[model samples]
Target: MNVGEWAGLVAAAGSILGGGGWFVSRATRDAARATAAATEAAARANAAPAQQQASLAVLEATVKRVDEENGSLRGKMSRLEAVLRAFAWTTDRWSQQMHRAGIEPEPPHPLVEEYNRTGV
Candidate 1:
């Protein structure tokens, strides 16, 4: 070929190779970015169940603690109720003995007065 034709052919080859290289580089970069994004998504998906279980464990422990505290409080309340009932029974027995002995118990206690007033 003549020098001019050879030069034109080289220019055409250079243009083709440059365009091909650019296309390949862009495609490879895009593929790498897509792979990175997919890997991050997969990691999060895999961890979700474990994270959920940890959260549930904390919730279960909290519920158990509350139940234990409530049970302790209920036991305390029951003992207090028993003590109060004993006091009331002893007071009533004393009042009955005083009345039978023909001795008036002093001024009625405030609780007795309230009971008399309300009939409760």
Candidate 2:
């Protein structure tokens, strides 16, 4: 071939190589980006279980607090019930004494009226 033809051929080869290199570089960059995205997603997936466990721990702590509060309220309710029972017994004894001495008994207390109303 003539020198001009050889030069043209060399230019064509260089153009083809340049285009191929550009395509390969683009492909490599895209693959790297995809790998990085997948790695980030995996990290997030791995952290999800630990986040859930922390949430469960908070829930367990709340339940324990409520249980303790419930126990304290139950104790207060027991004491109040004992006080009411003692008051009722004293009132009944007073009424019996008044009836034996021919005096009319006093009216029922508000709490006694409520208890009688509800039968609770």
Cα RMSD to the true fold for all candidates: 4.9, 3.9
Worst 10 residues of 2 by lDDT: 111-120
The C-alpha local distance difference test score for the whole of candidate 2 amounts to 0.92
Specify the highest-TM-score model's number.
2
Q: What's the distance in Å from true for residue 26, model 1?
A: 0.9
- Please provide, for model 2 over 28-117, each residue's C-alpha lDDT reduced to its tens digit, 9 standing for 90 to 100: 999999999999999999999999999999999999999999999999999998887787778788889999999997798787888757
- C-alpha lDDT of all candidate models, in order: 0.91, 0.92
In model 1, what is the error at residue 1, expressed in angstroms? 2.9
Best by lDDT: 2
Write out the backbone clash pairs for model 1: none
**TM-scores, all models, native as reference:** 0.57, 0.63
For candidate 2, give the lDDT of residue 92. 80
